[model samples]
Target: MNGTATHRTVIIVGSGPTGLLLAGDLATAGVPVTLLEKRSHDISNLSRAFGVHARTLEQLDARGLADQLLATGDTITGLRAFDRLTLDLTTLESRFPFMLITPQYEVERLLERRAREAGVDFAYESEVVGLRQDADGVELEVRGADGTVAVRRAAYVVGADGHHSAVRREIGLDFPGVSVIKSLFLADVRLAERPEDVLTVNGAGDCFAMIASFGDGWYRVMGWDRHHEVADDVPIDLDEVKDVARRALGSDYGMHDARWLSRFHSDERQAPRYRVGRVFLAGDAAHIHSPAGGQGMNTGLQDAANLSWKLAAAVQGWAPDGLLDTYETERHPVGKAVLRSSGGLVRLARAQSPALRAVRALVSAVGNTVGPARRKALGQISGIGYRYPALRGAHRLTGTRVPDVALAGGRLHEALRGGRFVLITPDPQAYEDPGTRKDRLTVECWASGRRTTVLVRPDGYVAWAADAPDATAIEEAVAAAVG
Candidate 1:
């Protein structure tokens, strides 16, 4: 170890939503966090992502951030696919049941603010070029904009940089996947006529287009003409963007005053492993996928949420054996599933062959008519369907996310604002004194008629639950979960 190297408890690379949220969470938990970013601190107005799902809203709500975000975005209670299947989120079980249509920069702005408020050390314009990890800590070689280089050390390091991550490369992790969609064009422009739908998306045989207002005067248009497989750097003509929109949606809503235009491709890739020794990867550094369902940024935020508490536990010296490993075990499956579903959506949208078109029609019909199919599809897309694997002999509720149920003190999510485990039981006496484990657990009586004891994790998942419980079981479960 270098004697003069700057050291922190945790160093997070990339100041995007994932790294910002992770740094905020760690800092909020009283863990010292340093955030490194290659870009300056200036916020950009252009964005590729526009939709935030319900589960992500729930996560933001847990941190008392949902209201601010909701204020900045418009809500769409229903989403249509294939111009036939309508996934209704209005009846979904969440405080924010609809998808929020806002610019990706808005989300990043909120996270960055939270991170700053939490006192995260920001090292902007500093790019991580190399990484080395030993049994105790990880060291990073960072190059500043002025060509100055420095070596920094941290007990743990996380890579939340995008798909072309230097940290992942330095660790020799393989991002094994292929490009799923190519030559997609994106444009942000002023719209003279606003669409009735909050989000309008449709795909024809060889063309696709999606339009969503930023709740500002500007609208984001994303589309692609399958016939044009141009390079990303090629300048995109406004007429081409409008032509694709007209082909897919029948009109461009008088799109004009182009603010931004670009061409890019989407890839479906996942790192072989999320962690290597003391270094870890999250967000785009760990996984990337098509932008079909707007899952990219939301999945990254959830990844940060899943990892932050565990990393905090590890830093605080209370994480049980294998707790840190569970981050990969739980989140890797979710990443794979996102890639599958998002890729499926892209394929469905691009279906042109007679057989594939027929299959797509059948799926749309079934999804529209079948209650379970619609519910499942909406749940998965909105991130409510995800569940971690339960441990042996664990409760049925274990691994499932805890809904924002009404509680005696406040909403279930409100109770989690402090970032502590909440134990709700019909019989509170079953658990030992909360005063003893106040730092790790909070005991509360059930709000209403529920004869079960449920232990909710910091990230809003049910860690353990039982219809009938005793002090011994509660103690053991707590010890097993948080040590």
Candidate 2:
């Protein structure tokens, strides 16, 4: 079949953070996974995504990698937006209550390490040239660094590839959206003077810019000039960055001596479907949005987290009915919400006219004065407040994100490292029955006097919960959830 296809349980296209995280998760869960990357094994030092949100950190924490990443990155407890509004990340209920500012490469390094150690078959410099799927499985035509093309088969295929995904094209999925910002340029340069704030952002009528430290001697300066808009192909130099910063940020902290500079555009796009038969898409392949709130990479990583355990369950043959379809049902709306929120931020940034300014004022006023709205904004940006849809008559806590509460053994995330649904019960004695034990489920007892018994998915969302200590109900729900 298809010229002797080499089979794998899953073939993940792309080696970016999404692919790496998904590949590592599957491998950690003992699924045979092959990660096909067009790039070589050598790591790149350059990074476009500098800020990792709190929710992503939590996901990594569950994977046992967050502390290492946090140790190396700078933490900002608050986010400055519109030069007036600030989101207090410290108020978040999660353990990581701040944004970690580090390059995307750092994340890749950690994930790649975990994946390699977990036995992921990495095919570096192997690009997906063609793909096909049938009722049984999916097939792929991968081209290696050499001229040779090889046919591969997999139970499922995931496109964690970037925006211009060959897998998406192969599957005939359209990434439908437009560019939100044009002629955006950024550079890592040394500032001759320090800014008033650790993270400086401002915008005049014609330009907008932001400055943040990399903790190294260099700084990242991102700027956009409305009056001098040009195609992304135009070459950007240190002067363009400096000029925009001076106009908007009022000095760019006397920025100079750029180490890296580039011009590009940002888009707000999401695939109409994240899953097609045996093939799936996650991360940038499924959705992308403006970096206005630094949500692009964070959203992609979260997509991978939502999809990984489901894929594992499916591969292991214990997945519940329609479990695979839930990936799109849960993640697609979150992708749309990210696009809307990030697009709104971009539009608000460029708002100059009386009407636009009024809208901006209203948003800022609401963010400052309204506690609920402010919390929502923080939740959206930090990726914490999102919940999947639950069926009718489900528990009130069903589909909501479960906080990392203290268990008798350890933290909730620590218990999730095995990539299994964790049932937190105050009545551990009741769950001691052999019927409650499942290979794909972990049972933990509460450290504190908690009345609610909650079943948390591997990705940290509550699958089922009950206020009453009903052992029979929990056993039935666990059987339905994991088996």
Candidate 3:
């Protein structure tokens, strides 16, 4: 193949959940997004990460894919501890209270479909070889099928590629973190044991086990075995993996017909900052951690959602450059917390000493007994624990995820689906002035049955809200955000 050239508003590297979701959002925002995937074929059955938390579900629901996901996925109430202790996450009270357990491949497929519907262009069998940032945009060198080379230019480039991201490398972002000491094995198999009372994480001598029930007769299981060394030259044996499972559970669990098997070494690395000039990194490119709480894929999806609107704002020229910097300010801390918590979780699970096991049992029992402790643990696993410091003021709901409130005509989420800053005010007259509408600023009038007005960003966080009657104050906050 020969050289070719193309142009797009945004060029997204990778076709994983993060890249596809951002492509869909940007396309929906009227930005032409070129999504390049190194893979030629559509991946239909990969099963790496499976847990989609409530917060992630809410984000997908806003994109109209929640119903499709819920249809094919298993709904888990909450995580279970060592033995009979079930956390009962149904008590969390999200419209999507339960964790949706679907494979990563399924989620990516759903996102690709949505992105296609939104008219996002996909360049498959294409690998990003090199990229350079210019004063105006980014120029990319891509290798396509048949060894054809092409040059593509875009206003912005997003690196949603995995841990070894070319985009991140091209921008020279340092990913600093330590790797785990122990290796863990994950397998999808049919278990002879009946469906358990909860997803189990057992603490046994020299090992720890985590298992989740999946669709069909298959169950996804992970465990650490000191005696087992992963060999890349040899395929994982079902019998060998079964032996590890039995030892980890301290019992002979009948496991058969292993579907997928692999070993993983954990890394708690993250890019020091998410944005590097006109190029940005999201998902695994920005952060990678142990799959302790099943937050890997969900965290990446949220990262894409957060970054997409900012890219859209930049393309439209309504967003200040400072507004884009807020992505790192808000998401970097979340990534760090994820790394810390995931590392702590792995350490806790792998503590093998008799005294350490006893201490862990006592702590788990005590924490389960207390409401605040239970809520805190649930929040950590579910990702509802994040609160950005940038949002501050009189708004009763500032710095919080905007609730899916019911308005006169529809859900509040409907008004925000188009990727624009929405100003919700009791009196529309204040923001209705023609001057505010000149710069692609969208103002919607809603009677919240209160004197206050709420301004929400495209990522579903409240920028500001007014508790008092003065429209002037609320207008100021909205004006600043929209500006």
Which candidate leads in lDDT?
Answer: 1
Q: Put down candidate 1 lDDT per residue, 1-483, tens digits, no spaces.
A: 223233338999998889989999999998888899999988788878889999999999999999999999899988888868788889798888899999989998999899889988899899998888887888899999899899889889999999899999999999999988878989999887889888988887689999998888889999989999888999888999999999999998999899899999999999989998888899999999999878999999999999999998998888888888989999999999999988998888788899988989999999988888888888889999899999798778899998898887879888998888988978756777646567777778778988888889999999888887778887887777766
lDDT of 3 by residue, 1-483 (tens): 112233338999988999999999998987888899898866856467878998888888777778888877788786766543457788775677788877777788899888999988888998889998877889889999989889889889999999999999989888999886446777888878754533656766666776666676677887767655454345566776666667666543578888788777778899987888789999999999988788888899989988898888788777764888888888888888888877776766666788877766775887679888788777777877576775434445777787666655576667666667777766667665457544344576664676567778887787887755475775567667776
Query: Which stretches in model 3 have alpha-carbon errors above 4 Å?
Result: 1-8, 82-86, 231-234, 250-254, 353-366, 391-396, 427-450
TM-score of each: 0.97, 0.96, 0.90
Best by TM-score: 1
Q: lDDT for every model?
A: 0.89, 0.88, 0.78
lDDT of 1: 0.89
lDDT for 343 (candidate 3): 77
| Pairs in clash, predicted candidate 2 | none
Better of 1 and 2 by TM-score: 1
Inter-residue clash pairs, candidate 1: none
**Candidate 3 to truth, TM:** 0.90
RMSD of 1: 1.8
| lDDT of candidate 2 over 1-483, digit per residue (tens) | 223233438889999999999999998998888899998887775678889998999999999999999876688899877857889888999899989988788899999999999988888889899999998799899888887899889999999889999999999999999999877887888988977655777888878898877777678888888888788778888877887888886785777788788888888889999999999999989988888899988998998999999998888788889999999999999999999999999999898789988889889989988999999999999999899999999989999998889999999999999988898999777675465345677889999998889989999999999899577888798888977
- Models sorted by TM-score, best on top: 1, 2, 3
Query: Which candidate, 1 or 2, would have the higher lDDT against the true structure?
Result: 1
Per-residue lDDT of 131 in model 2 = 95
